[model samples]
Target: MAGATLLPLATAGATAQGTATLTDIAGRQVRARLPARRIVLGDGPLAYVVALLRPDDPFTPIVGWGDNFRSADLGGYLAYRQRFPTIDRIPTFRGSNVGAIDIELAISLEPDVVVLNLSSRAAAESSGLVARLARAGVPLAYVDFRTRMFENTRRSIEIMGEVLGEPVRAQSFLQFRQRQIDRVMAPLRDLGHRPSVMVERAAGLYDDCCLSYGDGNFGELVRAAGGDNLGSHWLHGTFGTLHSEQVIAADPEVILVTGADWRLYSPTGDWVNLGPGADPSEGHARLRRLMQRPAYRTLAAVRRGRVHAIWHPFYDNPYYFVALQKVAKWLHPERFATLDPDATFRELHARFLPVAYQPGYWLSLNTDS
Candidate 1:
């Protein structure tokens, strides 16, 4: 695909027309031509870009993207490929996770705008990626959905829309997302007690004891879902590991494990294979194994069958309302007795996703739990 034809957003020696200056998530002034016809999106933020810009034709402006879509979430990749067969025709650059980006290959694609996650800004700057891209005359836009989801996710989407010339559609998506969140939060506004929840971030992904989010991402999601996150109180930043004794000491009421089919990364890994089209039996079996871990086996939450598993990638994308709703239902079942997160997810797909909604994003031990 290296020889694939490039979009004519600009000629070799001339600047594109109708350039605009905007502030990116990194507080940097980025001057780029408006209505970017060629775009290079980071893998983690690719789902949001597609959903917001062209839910029906996501490959339209994508000239290059990281390989996480295939390596991290095979179920999601298959769904998109089924809808848009030509998706594979687009060029793929080296992923941003393991190593430095292939600057030469990215420049060869000639993308008008490159979208990256704000979490990687420090690495981009320290590695001189910013200077190199500037010299190459390629514009970069930083967006975030993980850190400070409430504050910065919308701004990132707005920035993307402004650059892509889809401000109206972007606003529409934002409104839809807010409504979803409100539906879950408004009803529980008056609840006096919050469930003490422990979120195990990406269990078995690294063969470690316990990893979790602290005061951000899943931690914030727990709060938004009317639950108290033990990680936020113990850890200092967004992500950290806790000793097994500490988790047992906290004795959270709900133990939510974030997992995915990480076989590509760790072939024999113990992480849960829970995503689109996953079988409940398989998911439950994996959850059972996770519960057997020494750190979890003796915990009250595990013994009482309050343990649950959710998709891991929800932390990376903007459309996290589904996770929030599910978490709310699990943490406060009586309060949100009538809430249906599965139906809400299907509704979201009907309104925005190009592909049909496939079940199995999350699973719990027993329905009555």
Candidate 2:
């Protein structure tokens, strides 16, 4: 289609004009002038998005995280940060309650636009958070990341950049991220090896549960890392428990445990004693010891020292680049010996992340005293 043409007006005190248009998902052509600064991010990837944008984008004058403290994914993020320094510290961004945001708070912020993560429309409608924000004349745009598709990781970063007027930065970041993932996955493509793996979550208290990842998430990470997931076919949530029988039946080629106690489990409750936390060999020994337990001893991975602990930082946040690097290298030593993933992770965490990277994190398949 030809571009829309503009006609000059004869009226006095008139400014020059150009035709500009944008079409929303509903096919509605929104013909309007450009937006001004002052934006509010409803919840979800807002902080991450804000961080990716160059420091000078005035558009996101004010950002909000919304009431997402209840989400399981968010919980995973919090858990890691609470225990490990490598997981980037989550920045503070305000929002309304799960039911509705406090209007007065948002009004004081006075944003021009609002972006939302409408994963559960029901949650939004029930609380009226979206409706009230809309009533305030804040335009809301929803972008899905958690579920709509796994690829939305890059998409979310791009959308945040678009709104913040830092498309170049976002593009560069994405390219860097993709290349890192490719490097991690490339070595595994040709190898006919798969480590039957299991991921367990910290249930706050009580015994930990067996968490499984499917084709969508870190399971993809595991596949790229060159290991078969034992609990994967059993069909579990991203953070869920599996029957002991289920774990034994799969007979994993490798077991990757995640918990604050992982590299450093103890009868007493202290985490620092675990390996240097950055030393892969120390962590490796820790995992090796855990595999020797009577029940785990039957597993082939335990018998052959195939288990290792990849410190569970970078579970979320932009630090995903670091997590993938460590996980891929941990899974495929022969293929990625030159990668030096830990050093790369340390640097990325030091540069892009808000927190400092700690050492002796990723461990072997054994337990340490």
Query: Each candidate: what lDDT?
Result: 0.78, 0.50
The top-ranked prediction according to lDDT is 1
Per-residue lDDT of model 2, residues 1-369, tens digit only = 011221111121232333334333223243322232555556643454554353222113444445343132343334334434332422233432334555556656666555655453456567676677667655555554443233566766665554554556667667767877787767766787565676543312134335445553556566656766554575555444576667777776666665343322334321222212344553454445555544366877777766555434334345465566766666676777888766765554444443344555555554431
Which regions of candidate 1 are displaced past 4 Å?
A: 1-17
RMSD, one per candidate, in order: 5.3, 10.0
Worst 10 residues of 2 by lDDT: 1-10
Once superposed on the true structure, which residue ranges of model 2 sit more than 4 Å away at CA? 1-46, 55-63, 66-108, 115-122, 143-145, 148-150, 203-208, 236-240, 260-305, 309-313, 347-361, 365-369
